[model samples]
Target: MRRVLIIGGGVAGCATALALHRAGFAPVVFEGHPDSGEDIGAFLTLAANGMAALRELDAAIAVGRAGFPLHTLEFAGGVRELAGHRCLRRAELCRVLQAEVARRGIPLHHGKRLASAAEDADGITARFTDSGIARGDVLIGADGLNSRVRALVSPGAKPRYAGQQVFYGYSRPRRPPCEPGRIVMVRGEAAFGFAVSPGGETYWFARVSTVESPEPSWRESLLALLDKDCAAIVAATRGPVLGTNARDLAQIPRWRTDRMLLIGDAAHAASPATGQGASMALEDAVVLAKAMRDTANPLEVYEQLRRPRVEYNTEASGRMSARLPPMDVPPPVSEEELAGQLDWSRRVELTAAE
Candidate 1:
């Protein structure tokens, strides 16, 4: 069997492992976290294309079990729809991916922090913090926005903040019937709020106009900022929110080097502006794996398949970022203007496999 090593066993990494395994490759996922289930909290929208990709990896059913199925997508800035997807919980989605990985007997190594990696003409070897090495015929960087493997391969490429920051968290029902299954978006001055997830709990996040993203101290800052952005969400989601300050990233061009390849956020990232980050990442994994499976010279196919798609998404995200209203005042947009906006979401090949 073809052997592959995946770095950063987060969603992208785990998803890559699942896809590559299904393609008849032996994949080992190395996660920096101590375990599979960790404190990482965020809700990812499993848009149809993303959902289909997960099904290909045989992870979608578990994903559905972990969270509620997403039914709609609503963009509420002056109350308009930009894009919609079936959304889900990030934590639960990870668990589902874990279950899929385990079901297929894919190896998962946690707490094995990656230090660096290099590729030779013959193979690739990744070095971990403990000075251990994992080698394979090919190496994939599934690490997220801040991908270590990417830095080593293409030092020039870096994740740039899309001029916005977000603060969000999850809260159990302090108030029920917040209209479950409905993704409610509130467009306000210099901010936008949206709520959706499984179990009737709301994953609320508010994006603020800012140059820098919120740092580790952002959770406390988010507590206060969210109060200003949308109080009802702050109240309804209740206490103990995941508190991820939103910071979208854009990748520098040039995604591949030699036999090593990058996938998901490793290659490119999207702003929540389009609300398709997770779906895009899932699509990245599936496309990368398919290119790898069908072509012997995969580096070319990988770049050819991934660049246009990532570029299409990055461009769409850029458009969305520019559309953000002044942080204190909702942009003056006519209902017709808003209504005339193009829906750039992709049409998926639903029959990928489950």
Candidate 2:
């Protein structure tokens, strides 16, 4: 079995570990944080495609327990039923995935930040900021946006702001709540979206166009941009609001170097406007593991398979964040084709033609 060294024990890293382990690889994960609580303030939706990937890894039920299901999406047009999408805090998802990683007895080291890495003909060596070292036959960089491993894979590749600043917060709305399991998107002075959890706490986010990022008084500034109902949700919130400039990687000329490779946000991070970051990362985990399981040249095969779909997502998401009219973007891999690709029992090469 190949000894796989995985960097970043977030969503992508943990999921990658689970997939690789099931594929019979000896995978070890190194997390920068001392615990699985990074990004506790922010939440994300894992789309149907992501859930499908989890089911392939036999992790769906464990992960499904943390968050509530989202069945419908409401917008200016109309409400449409969703396929089994889930809404949960980013940290909660990490913790659940990390617990499963532990349950399987996979080795996950904490507080081990990657300072640098060197690869040779024989293997790859990872040096940590804590002065620890691990050597493996292959290294997978699941590190997120602002990835250090990305610098090694594709030098000068950096994430650019997608022309929007996003704010996230949770509130118990005094106003009448929307139906449960429904996500509402409002297009006003800014792009806003919210969902009421099963517990009645509303999870909301606002995206505002700005050349300069907003100040620390994000609540007041954000409320000013929302309509009455949206403003009321923000006003009822009691805690600190989380905000950041929406960012994405336009393209990376390279995604692999011999034994080292980048996956997830490290390889192709899309703007949050698309709500596909976590789903895309989950897809990467399953596909990459399948590549490793079936091929001698996994790095090359993985890139060829993933590049088209992920790049399409990156382009589409960047356009949405910029508030630009949608262009004739290349359509991503079809749903049926992707399902065939993610099927664990099927050999990856057989699905390549679809």
C-alpha RMSD for every candidate:
7.3, 1.8
User: Candidate 2's C-alpha lDDT?
Assistant: 0.89
lDDT of 1 by residue, 180-209 (tens): 566666555335445555456667666665
278, model 1: CA deviation in Å? 1.5
Residue 331 of model 1 has an lDDT of: 35
Write down the TM-score for model 2: 0.96
Give the alpha-carbon lDDT of every model: 0.66, 0.89
What TM-score quantifies how close candidate 1 is to the native fold? 0.81
